[model samples]
Target chain A: MSELWAASALSVRIAAVATLVTVLFGVPLAWAMARRKFPGRGILEAIILMPVVLPPTVVGYALLMLFGANGWIGRYLGGYSIAFRLEGAVLAAVVVALPMLYLPAKAGFAAVERELEDVATLMGANRWQTFWHVSVPLARRGLLSGIVLAFARALGEFGATVMVFGWQPGRVTLPISVYAQFEQGDLNTALPTVLVMAIAALGLVLVYNALASQRD
Target chain B: MKHALIRLVVLSAVLLGVPTARADSIRVGAAVSLKEAFGEIATLYKADTGETVEFVFGSSGQVAAQIKSGAPMDAFVSAAKKQFDDLVKDGLLDVETRHLVAGNELVLIVPAAAVKGGAVGGFDDLKKDAVAKIAVGEPKTVPAGQYAAQTLKALKLDDAVKGKIVFGANVRQVLAYVERGEVQAGIVYRTDAKESGDKVTIVATADAATHEAIIYPAAVLSKTEHGDAAGHFLDYLMSEKAVAVMRAKGFSIPTDPAPAAPAKPATP
Candidate 1:
């Protein structure tokens, strides 16, 4: 029972941080791609959306090359190794869930009428101000749904996370715990953990649907 | 609906739980083969001593590699002597704390219904047409597979059963195959066979002499911060109580003190 709670706590914490990071990077990129057409825009979109189509193991491998001690990105970080730790898990989740948020948020941004932004600019609103005040408010539903979708995707990520940070004590997430228990034939424990994840995912999907529903 | 977005953001703020301080727990890296028994022992250990034993179960090689790279494990329990010896050579494991926890026998298991059939009796029977596929661990990686291969070669049955063998990733997968009747039989650790309960029946024990000795060795990591705590848990694993649980799980207790039993009570 305590194992269940510990796993849940660890998972929620990792996924929360991952979701926050996803939105931080995802929202901006999504908006950019949604608003302007730049050179290599198709290539950029393909890369951003690659994670959604690629197998988690492939994504995990790419991240490993970037973050692993011997890899380019990792070599620069010096003494900070993310292997088998919270940060690694968060990174895996963010990579895998980024596209989920980006896709919907792009749609949300695209749905926002260009006239509204023009109206804000005409009223002397700066680009940043118009973004926060007019663009964001108009695209609220798509963005909200995207955020929820990303959160749910991150919560369920397992393979890439495992590949990035192999299993570790004090780092067990709900999916990992369930897999561990099931491997040991301990269905009694695994079943409850599975139930917890199922409920969590269901709740997130509900939130997504609620936000996506147009009340006006 | 009016402030739904604001409420949702607040909700995420709560879900973004503040990182809590780690509890008084020692992280132990152990072989994947020990997953079930070790988990049970950890649970009991927590009950007996209010301290926790958190584990990271993986292949002996993977776990050892992690330890070498400074994976923050307080203790290590390897499924084979080779991995333990390698770590000891690297001065990663405390030599003094190292001990032989248990040894294991390779068991041949078949689906429950096939147990009584005369069609499959021993290693030789695996060659028969009735046994279409016989599951064993991949000899290159899985310890159980290596031992099973050794046993067949030692018993002069390797050529006879070679064509019928289907390799699994690990002992647990072999047991799963046997339990599902996907394979007519499987060769896996005794503990794995036992975990399947009645779903699979042990057809034969691949005598210990036929293969290299299967040993599980444990020791504290020399770099561990909680040396005393990890040592205590290691001692508990070799304690009479924990040994009893391992024995019931079908593991061989090699150095277990001769049990004080088989004598009638004086009163009786």
Candidate 2:
């Protein structure tokens, strides 16, 4: 029972940190994808969606190259010695879950009625005010779905986290610990870990479905 | 007539090249520590025999599972005796063709800065709060894990170190844990610790008698259609050239007494 709490707490931490990072990058990207009409919009969308299609290992290695101790970003951050620990796990999770957050936020942004923004603008609301006050409230449903889905996606991420963090228990998130257990053939120990993850996944899906309903 | 003869020669060359190209490409499941060394061997093998060797370098347990579950493999080189023995028991390996191709030593290593070049210390320090985490291989599948567990039990430190012990999926992972400074110390094969270079610190060597002798075995799978080719590869793995490569990679020569029955009694 204590072990279950420990594992669940770890999972929740990973999901929360990943969610926070995703929102930091996701909202702006979603806005751009929604409001900007650029020449390479199709290519940008494809690049953003690449994680959904690319092998998780490839994404992991890319993350490793970008954030490994000797990696470019990693070295800069290594002044603080930050990669391949809990922070690296969160970063890997964020990269994979970013698209899940971005696509839905973009859709939600798009779904905001143009007339509401027009009315806000005519009422002396500036662009930023119209966005924060008008646009966000109108499309809250899609944004909520995106956040839930993003958290769920981050929670289940195994490959990228494993390759980046290399399964440092207690420091790495839960998916890695599950994989290490599986590799060790302690399926008995692993069963609880799997159950916890599954329930979390199911909870996220339920939340997404509820928010999606609100959107409809 | 001349043009038709030229076409015939070109067609014959293409047909022969196609089969030889396919035949030359052979896949071998190698232990993780051998990744770079085997890559070099593969190049040599290609140069000498025109055979291109592809290696899937990972934990021997993982490679063995993959092979047992029908991964297309011609040969398997494992870091432990049990994996090969189990493969033989599974009827996947040709029983008569197995060989003890190499041996490795498990060592207790710490960050170099932690211990001032001391000839490896005793386990007494391991229990101290100063030692926050100790990395070790998972005992179920990784040979290094089994050896480390056995050594711990032999020294009666298993219970003492239980809380501070962090399990790695393989010996390499154990090294990574220590190298990344996530763990204060770790147990890995001497080869693996060496592979970490200055990233890790080696505190001491585990007495060879403390646990079972670490013998690595290699064998050709019975299901291989290229049995002759695999047999040749196994021969190379046992040859002087291969021994030199293994030695350079930190595989010890088995000079100790025979491996005891594994720590836990065999399941039978």
Candidate 3:
């Protein structure tokens, strides 16, 4: 039972950190794609959205090769091994959850009325000021729902996390814990961990649905 | 929409029915560690008999669990005796058909770069702060990991290296971790370590007395529909041709007489 709690807490921690990262980068990228016109825009958008269509295992394997100890980026970050650690699991979740957040956030940024932003700019507000004061407030509801969906998806991540982190018990999240339990032939333990994850995911979706309906 | 749905259902039905339509094949569940050897043996069996032998490879414990859950397997080749014995006790396997196939040795490995000139002594060196992480398969579910744990405990290094251990799903993953230099060292089968080419070098071989014998056993499942075909495959697995393949892959073919033990089935 305590093991389950530890796993649940670890799951929440990884998902929360992943959701924060998704918002930090995803919102800005989605904003640029939505409001700006540039060469290679389609290609950039396709690249960002690739994770949504690609199998999670492929994404996991690619991340492993990119961030593994001898990996291109990892080799330079010497002494700070990311693979087989909690940070790797968090990174896997962020990569897997990025598209879920970005797609909806992109649509929200596109739906924001251009007139409101124009009015803000006309009133002497800088572009950055306009973005925060007018654009973001209007798109808050969609972005919030996107965050929730990304959090739920990150919490349920398995293939990529396992591929990158290899199911270290102390650092393992809920889905990996469930898989480990199943592999160890303890379905009794796996079922409850699965239930806890399912209920938490259901609750997150419910909150998102509420926020989405309230937006109307 | 309804017409498309009907077409989709028919398409899926035909796709799912294709495998069962060809009933001449036999499905064998084997440990992932036996993949290279069994793959060659499978090819040889096909060439000689013109019969198809499909394989499902995974950790021995997982394969055992699948067999217990009534997986469509005609034969099971496991890397550990416990899983095979458990199945035999459960009456899921034909006890009379069980035979020792091969054995393996466990060894400690380090990345080639880490071993500059001298090897890192033995189990005690694994405790040095410089050796941050050590990869092993999940001990409870993988036979190789079980052997590693047993060896560690025997050497009294289990407590010393507790926190530094990172578990993989199977032996191959452990080798990958070492090959990629993710961990300073790892414990895996001698065969696996040998196959890792220039990426890793053996530091020490674990004493066989430290752990249960690393044995491979093969048997026919009681629920097999194709009994004669399954029996023939079992015989083929013990044939000289198969033994040669196993030997080439570094498996030590057992030459000892079968042990006499209580043959009572589990009272489930």
Least accurate stretch of 10 residues (summed lDDT) in model 2 chain A?
A75-84
Better of 1 and 2 by DockQ: 2
lDDT of the structure predicted as candidate 1: 0.80
Please write out the lDDT profile of model 1 over residues B71-175, one tens digit for every residue.
888999887777787888897988777767888888988888667666777787887888766778756446787788899999998887866776564577677
Q: Evaluated on chain B only, what is the TM-score of candidate 1? A: 0.81
lDDT of each residue in B179-243, candidate 2, tens digit only: 75556789998888887888877667888888987887777788988778877877776656766
Query: How do the candidates rank by lDDT, highest first?
Result: 3, 1, 2
**Model 1 interface Cα RMSD in Å:** 17.1
| TM score of chain A per candidate | 0.96, 0.91, 0.95
Write down the lDDT of every candidate, Cα atoms only.
0.80, 0.77, 0.86
Most TM-score-accurate candidate = 3
Tell how far residue B53 is off in model 3, in angstroms: 3.0
**Angstrom error at residue B98, model 1:** 0.7
Model 1: per-residue lDDT, tens digit, A6-75?
8888888988999999999988898899999899999989998998889998987787677764446775
